[model samples]
Target chain A: MEAFITYTLFAMLVATALAAVQLNRLFAVVMLSGVFSLLSAVLFVVLDAPDVAFTEAAVGAGISTVLMLGTLALTSRTEKSSSRSSAIPLLVVIVTGIVLVYGTLDMPNFGSANTPANTHIAAQFIEKTPHQIDVPNIVTAILASYRGYDTLGEVVVVFTAGIGVLLLIGRLGRRGERQKQIGRGE
Target chain B: MRHHLILRVVTKLLAAPIMLFALYVQFHGDFSPGGGFQAGVIFAVAFILFGIVFGLDKVQQVFPTWIVHRLMALGALIYGGTGVVTMLLGKAYLDYSALAHHPEHGQHYGIFAVELGVGVTVSAVMISVYYAFAGRPPRISDEEW
Candidate 1:
């Protein structure tokens, strides 16, 4: 089981790296980036970090994808392959990949129940939370109560984004009326 | 789209349940995986389905762009108002513990109210945004319900 999880994690990392190397369509690249984020979330969950995984999945996969799609809709979808960028980003990626692999040399194996992270504040939170909040779902209790301020800020940020979008696109009423006037040859 | 008999029946029949489920999810968060976000999505899904089936202009008559626009502000007021109430009760902002005889129950009640505000704002915003994108002059509905 442990070996399978490790191999799956390794495969996902390699797949993301390969996608990063191969995709040329800008939209496709953005979608693959979402895939990368989702896989990263899965990796975090495999390490029993559900809260981080939840926020990463929501922000990285959901909000970022929406923002990128909105940008793509405003611009063009094609990646400029007219001039070939054969090597620069690829070399950078390869070097970063190697550095990452080197960094992971001393890291704990995937799904190990005894890592330092699992033994520290994380363990404390998990172990002692029942006594403090009395909520069955510790993650929700923590997110809603102990760390409620962070969630409130996140909600405020979302509300602000709604306001921003309304200011930009909702103001299209006047522009829409102007366009109609032009259409009528006035 | 106008001639699809299946879609017409499905949208008409499904709209009621979707709204019901949205309400259920809003209040039933404790026993389920749903809350404000899911309820809002479900509500928007119903309206979007209606727009797809009957047409956006028809939906506009029922919901009206003006009402949805006001709902955006109204939801925010409801959410922020809770905090104001807490202040009046001699506590910090959004202190739901002051809301009830037992403060713990007040927390549950407070969460529900805020969740409802979120649901309304989200559903209104989503449907209104959809209306903005689905462009045409307008449609004349032969039947009004």
Candidate 2:
């Protein structure tokens, strides 16, 4: 059942990728990219990382698609630059994909109890967490408590990205407001 | 747009719940799948939705740019202060063991405070960034990137 599900998802991903690449309209490409992200999130859930899956769904399918559409609004939404797609970039992409797939061949067998992650300090956190916090979700316990620092750091990183965006757009906002006031005066 | 009557009404109704959910995610993070980062994104999304449905100018009116800037720094300050309090109480940096009279309870108290700080900073900054992006000034000369 699991193998069938995984194979189906992989097929969906391939179809989506082909759709994204072959689409003539930039809008269609962006929308197909969103579809691809949703499939990837589903795959993540099937792999037992529900938290990661949730985030991928939220950020990848939701926010990223919105951002792409917003950018699409300000620019041409049709593929006007297809003349630039030549042999070099395509070869580079193919090589990178091949290397990545080859690297996955040496991956550890699935769900091994004696795996390093399951037997190390991580195991202690995973094992003791439920008793300490009484939370059924062991991942949540590890993130919120035992490894809270990393989570805090991630929050700070997100906050920093927000600050960076604010800095970049601050002047633009003021100018926009001024123009709005000027328009109202007319 | 003002013409999108459904959007306007939905956004008005959703604005409160989104903010409230962010708070819930922030506070209940210790027991749930949500935390500061997720809360921040949702909070930002709510305001971003408001900005999109309404005008950026109106959204800015609701949360002025200046307030957002101060919130960015304030979040870090609150987070650091918790650590400072722990140190003052003779524990390691961010050692929530000192947050309450009893060490175990203190851990809970400390984590909550820090998470609140994280949530506040995250929500504010996220909204601020979206405001920056959505509310950008129209170009005098049309250009493409």
Candidate 3:
């Protein structure tokens, strides 16, 4: 039953992706992309990755969709039709997709126990977490205690990205005042 | 948007619950599927929904840009500070065992602090990014949307 649900969700994801690619209206494209993310979240759940599914649902569907809509507000709603030939780009895309699909062929089966991912350091984390952190959730234990520095680095990266965005487009201090003045003039 | 009676009413009713849920995800992360990143996005979603319905100006009034900016830095500081505290306690950086007599207690404390830091920064950054994008004089007007 779970496998059935997973296949159904994958089918929906493919349809949504195709629709998003074919649509010229940016609004519909954005909505379809949101649907794509939500479908991926369901797939994550079927795969028993609830933590990842939660993040995908919140960040991908919720935040990204809103951000994309905001971008659409600032840009054109409809995609501009390019007169240039699309043959080369299409070929490149096809080649890349083929290469990616080929690469996945060597991957271990989804939940196989003997896979490298399951055999490597994961064994120690599972074995020692009860004695070390004593946390009920192994995911939290690995992320926060075992790999604290990495998570701290991630937080710093997020902070830096925020600052970069603020520097580029944030209406702050004098810039905000100027924007307000421009709004009034309009 | 100002005249969208149902949207305004529903948004107002939903915002608090959304925030409450974010908090639950943030604090209950150790035992559940959620964590700071998800909670942060959820928190920002509440504010973004309000901004969409009631207008950006009102949302800004409630959560000013300065606060968001400060929070973005503050969260990173909190995460780094936890590491620094551990180092000061004569343990390696980010060593939670230094925080308490029992290793488990220290781990709990360290994780809670860092998760709070992560949640604060993620939500603030998400909000600030939204503000940067939406605060601009939109190319399309409200009627068009």
Candidate 4:
């Protein structure tokens, strides 16, 4: 039953991708991408990574969709048809896809217990988290306690990205006043 | 948008609960499947939804751009400050064991503080990005959609 569900989800994901590609309407494509995110979130849940599923649902399906709509509002609604031939781009994509599949051929089978990833420090984290952190959620323990530095780094990266965005497009501080001055032709 | 009665009413009804849920995800993360990043994004969604239904100016009044910009830095400061405090206490950076007499309790404290930092920064960043995108004048009119 689980396999059936997974297969169905993968099929739906492919269908959504195909539909999004085929649609020239930017709005429909955005909605379809949201659908794709939702499907991928469900797949994450089926794979027993609920934390990932939550992030995917919130960030991918929810926030990204809103951002895409906002972008669409600022830009054109329909994709402009390019006069250039797509044959080369299609070929490049196909070749990259094949190479990616070939690269994955050496990966350990899904859910294998003795995989290196499962055999490594993952076992230690699982064993020590209960006593060291006393947190019921091991993912949180690992993310915040064990790997605190990495999480801190991630937060800083987020901060830097926000500042970059604000500098580029956000009207803040003296920049807003300057923009107003330009608008007023002063 | 102003004439979209259903959207306005629905947003009004849903915004508070959505925010409450974000808080739940933020604090309850240690026991659940969610954490700071997801909570932050969810929290931002509420404000974004309001902005979408009402207007940028209305939402900005409630959460001004200045506050959002400050919050973007404040969260990272909190996270880094926690580490600095730990280091000052004679432990390595981000070593939560020094926060309390008991290492386990200290770990809890550290995780809570750090997660809060993550949550704050994420939500602020998401909101600020939304503001940046939505604040701009649209090239196309609503009628185009």
Candidate 5:
């Protein structure tokens, strides 16, 4: 049953990606991408990574779709046709896909007990988290406690991106100054 | 949007619950499947939904761009300041063990504080980005949608 569900999800994900790529309407493409994200979130859940599934659903499916819609409002709704041929890009993509699949062939089977990832510090985290952090969720303990520095860096990165966006297109100055600048642009 | 009574009413109904869910995800993360990043984005989704349904001006009145920008900085400060506090207490940077007499309690406090910082920054940044995108004049009209 799980295998069937996973297969169905992968099929749907591929279909969504293909549709998004083929669609010329930017709006539809954005919506399809949201669907893709939703499918990926489900896949993550099936893989037992609920934390990742949550992030994917919220960030990828929800916020990204809204932001892309906002972007479409500011720009064109339809994609412009490219004059260049797609054959070279297709060849490159196929090559990359083949290489990636070949690479994954050497990976341990899904959820194998003796996989390096399962054998490594994961056991230590699982063993120690209950006593050291007393957190019910080992993921949270690892993210917020064990790897706190990395989380801090991620937060600062988010902060920096926000500042960058604000400076670029945000309402940065006083209302009067902005109005004057708009007046000058006209 | 003014004429879209269903959307407006539905948005109004949904916004509060979404915000509440975000908070739940934020604080309950240690026991559940979510954490600050997910919670923050979920929180921003509420405000973004309001902005979309009711129009930008109304949402801005409620949230204000200035406060959003300030919050964008404040989250990072909270996270970094926790590290600084630990350092002052004679532990390495971000060592939460020094936070309380009991190391486990300190870990709890540290995780809570750090997650809050992550949540605050993420939500604020998401909202701020939405503002930047939506605040601009649209090249196309609503009829285009």
Candidate 6:
């Protein structure tokens, strides 16, 4: 039953992707992409990665859709048909897909206990989290406590990106002269 | 927009719960699936909905752009400051063990503070990005849609 559901969802996901690619209307394409994100999130849930599923639903489906729609408002609604053929890109994509599938053949089967990911450092984290951090959720413990430095770096990266965006397009509210100086081409 | 009676009414009704949920996600993250990033996005979405329905100008009155910029910086400061505090206590940077008498207590405190910082920063950045996009004069008019 689980396999059936997974396969069904995967088929729907593929269909959505193809539809998104075929559509010329940017709005419909954006909405399809949002649906794709949502379907992926459901797949993530079935795979028992609720944390990842939550993030995917909120960030991928929610915020990204809004941002893309905002962008669509700024630009043309319909995608321009390219003068060049898509054959070269299609070939590249097929090659990459084949290589990726070949590469995944060597990976351990899903939920295999003896896999390197489960056997190696994961065991230690699972064992030590209760004694050390005493957090109820292991994900939080790992992200916020065990790998604190990495999370800090991620926050810094977010901050820097925000700064970059603000500098580029934030319009500084009251500094009309500065806004003009910064090149108000848009 | 002024004629969007149903949208305005629904938005007015929905705004409070959305913010309430965002707070729940932010604070309950340690025990649940959500955390700062999800909470922040949810929080920003509430305001963005308001901006979309009520008008960008009114939403700005509630959450000014200057404050949003400051919030983006302030969250990072809060996060870094937590680490600095640990350092000041003669421990390594981000060493939560140094924050409290009991190591677990310190870890709890540190995680809470740091996650709060993340939530604040993420929400501010999301809002600012929305504002940046929405603030621009739309090249295409609403009737065109």
lDDT of 5 by residue, A50-108 (tens): 99999999999999999999899999999999999999999999999999999999999
Recovered native contacts, candidate 1? 0.00
lDDT (10s digit) by residue, model 3, range B94-124: 9989999997899999999999999999999
CAPRI-style quality class for the chain A–B interface of candidate 4: high
Instruction: Tell me how far the alpha carbon of residue B65 in candidate 2 is from the true structure, in angstroms, after superposition.
Output: 1.7
Give the residue spans of candidate 6 off by over 4 A. A173-186
| Candidates 1 and 5 compared by DockQ, better number | 5
Per-residue lDDT over A85-126 for candidate 3, one digit per residue giving the tens place of the 0 to 100 score = 999999999999999999999999888999988999999999
TM-score: the better of candidates 4 and 6: 4
Compute DockQ for each candidate against the true complex: 0.16, 0.30, 0.86, 0.88, 0.90, 0.79
Q: Enumerate residue pairs that collide in model 5.
A: none
Interface C-alpha RMSD after superposing true interface residues, each candidate, one decimal = 5.8, 3.0, 0.7, 0.8, 0.7, 0.9
Which docking band does candidate 6 fall into? medium
* Tens-digit lDDT string for candidate 2 (A1-186): 999999999999999999888877887899899898899999998998766776777678867776676666656668776667579998999999999999988877788777787788877877776555555566656665567677668767877787677656556366788999999999
lDDT of each: 0.69, 0.75, 0.93, 0.94, 0.94, 0.90
Pairs that collide, model 4? none
RMSD for each of the candidates? 6.9, 5.3, 3.6, 2.2, 2.7, 2.9
Candidate with the larger TM-score of 2 and 5: 5
* Ranking 2 against 6 by lDDT, winner: 6
lDDT for each residue of candidate 6 in B1-145, tens digit (9 for 90 to 100): 7888999999999999999999998888888888887888899999999998888999999999989989988988988899999999989998898999999999889999988899899999999999998999988889887
lDDT (tens digit, per residue) of candidate 1 on A1-186: 966895798798788868866877777888888888888888887777665665466557754564565455545566666577759977998899899999999999865889988787778778865665444555555544455456456455555656666666555478778999999995
Candidate 4 displacement at residue A116 in angstroms: 0.5
TM-score of 5: 0.96
Candidate 1 local lDDT, B51-85, one digit each (tens): 86797789998898778877866666667777788
**Candidate 4: tens digits of C-alpha lDDT, residues A86-181:** 999999999999999999999999999999999999999999989989999999999998888889889999889888987787766576688889
Rank candidates, lDDT, best first: 5, 4, 3, 6, 2, 1
Identify the candidate with maximal DockQ.
5
Q: Mark the 10 consecutive residues where model 2 chain B has the least summed lDDT.
A: B136-145
